[model samples]
Target: MKNKALYTLLIILVQSLHTTALNAQRSTPTEQINPYRIVERCTLHGISLLNNLDTYLSGYNYTGAGYYFNHENLRNAHTGNYNWKYLTTFSATLGYTKQQSNSQFTLLASRYWSGYHPFRVSNRLQLWTGAQIQLAGGALYVPANGNNMVSVKMRTALAATGIAIYRLPVRQHTIDLRYRIDIPLAGIMFSPEFGQSYYEIFGLGNTHGVIKFAHPLNSPSWQHTLSADIPIGNNTLRIAYTANLYQSKVNSLRTHIYNHSFAIGFAKTIYKIKRKDSMKAYSPLL
Candidate 1:
């Protein structure tokens, strides 16, 4: 009887230990999962020097100073994705130019959406190649010309874009040096034929040759941006120089718009937290 009781006690003790072990394992926490997305947003303001020439409106080059505004948002393509990112940007400019006694006022705006795949070259350098779709519209108005005082601009293009970022350690912080470029491949644009007036196209309903297909051969355009991000206290200060060259020869008419600008901006990063349902659905086995 004593031996039987001892055996039963041992079995009971073993079962207790097993239950304790399982309880401890269940109580231990799993590795924390990140439930937030990081996003970068920036806004910039600057002064642009504009040079414009449109054979439909004027034969002389018009040049002047303009105000420029730019806004951008950048984020990863998806949760837990480090190889790809997405960016969206909007920019606008307003200015005027004069040649002799003729004055031309211009307004321009463009929006771009892009996706990039990053190639890490080193610990300090990264190269990103991307593609973008751009939508642009603007108008140039000259008061001196009658019946054809306004030249409207509208275009959409698919562009090849690239960015290079280099990190430089300075004291206790790092400064990012970046360069970006964009070249349009092909798209469509709205243009009136040579010697065609808006009255003839809109009022008189002569709409032929108003919409044209564009390619590198007919509309060769590119943009360049060089920028630096400097950390200041709790904020990042961005200083940039941007140059845009746009040219097109279509419908027997020639047009070009060139702008160079120095810009100042602030960049900030924010985290977007997952919702309660998302958090619950992401539970993992411990």
Candidate 2:
């Protein structure tokens, strides 16, 4: 009886050791799912309309290109869901009209704080409202006018911005449709008189009230952009159209510039490492 009991105890010990060794070999690995920290998009614009107006009133139609860069940081706070966006754009147009040749170069920078709200229209719909601070400075060179050959422009304003976004899911593909608009409320702009020359302002030190306060009533300007994103493999393709309308009357000189651009670009997502049980990748739907 003692020998039989020893054999059974040995069998049970060997079985326990085998089970433990298998478990150790098959242990799960530690994984982490992190969020995208940065996103970069490059766009090439085809400008179709480049129109300008002065006392002589002329219009030009041609093709021009520009670049746009944007950075967004998102965070959830106790107050609400908010994000910060910084954008910069540089564009130049060169063309000629019946009256004269019109060329313009524009540089703009804007920073905005946008808060997202759930839209009742649908579960996939969202609306964002925010305030933006922008600084825009540019120059327009009209070759016809010997007196005012170059028009120097500087504008800074606090503007209101809004965005509407909707997502559509088709099988395994998702598409994002979004429209954004900005209107300047109030700010300061620099303009010269009807016949004032640069030599008079800087060379002769005759600058008085060159800086004028601007509002929608006086300087009505609007900027609108409509864009769509479609996923292609791991990256996204963006198609967009942008329209800019600017008009202001200061120092007895009337100015208006209208620009329309069609843009195509690619979107990329940036990711970071997180510590968790299983490794995964995460990205925003928009």
Candidate 3:
């Protein structure tokens, strides 16, 4: 009887321990199972049609061909919301234009960072609204002018941005159609006064009226992007068209830079795993 009682106690202990282990496994957090972050990177090359007019350089509108390179990164925000994402973009452009014997060149570089929150409109459509901060600087070179050959451009702005995405299924593949637009709300810009030479502003230390407040009335700008992402094999190809219209009137000088570009790019998704979580884990379905 004593031997039977001991055996029964052992069996009960073993069963209790097994039950506890199973319960712990079932209660494990979802994040521990999916310990990786996903990031999408894209690089694009494009040709641009540029229309530039800078009264500081000349009274004529300079029109010509240009080229641009764009790189972007997108990732889910760390706020634990799957519908929120962060986007960063960097772009550079070089343009060349000519008028009667005068040739002009423009070099521009810009960076944008945005945080977007998405609202599902339907099973296949989503609308994202966001705010963007933009930093842009450039210089226009006119070799014909002796003293005032370079017109500098620098600005920073807070913008309201929105994006619409639609998913279309064709046969066995899906295509994502996206449209994005950005409008600057308020900002500050650097501009020299009309007929003011760089020498007076920099060399002579006459710094008055160089920095100006920008608003829609003084500096109206818009950026529009239309793109389609098509899945091919294991990769995604993006074809895009972008229109950028920038204009500012400050210090009695009027300036505008317009560009229309067509771009082709590829996007790749990367999974980032921490060293501690090097082992494979079960990923949740989307």
The candidate scoring highest on TM-score is 3
User: How well does candidate 2 score on lDDT at residue 26?
Assistant: 36
Q: Give the lowest summed-lDDT range of ten residues in model 2.
A: 277-286
Estimate the TM-score of every prediction. Answer: 0.82, 0.68, 0.83
Q: What tens-digit string does per-residue lDDT give for candidate 2 at 1-286?
A: 9999999999999989877765654363234332333434444444435556654223343234445443344332234443344333444444342332445443333444444433446778887666667677666655555766677768888888777778889788989887888888999998876667888988898888788999987789988978888899887887877777778987777777666657677765544335331132221121
- Model 1 is weakest, by summed lDDT over 10 consecutive residues, at 277-286
Which one is best on lDDT?
A: 1
lDDT per residue as tens, model 3, 237-263: 999898888999887789999988888
* Ten residues in sequence with the least summed lDDT for candidate 3: 277-286
Ranking by TM-score: 3, 1, 2
**Which parts of model 1 are misplaced by more than 4 Å?**
1-36, 79-82, 274-286
How do these models rank on lDDT, best leading? 1, 3, 2
Colliding residue pairs in candidate 2: 31-277
- The local distance difference test score of each candidate is 0.89, 0.63, 0.87
The whole-model C-alpha lDDT of candidate 3 against the native structure comes to 0.87
Model 2: lDDT equals: 0.63
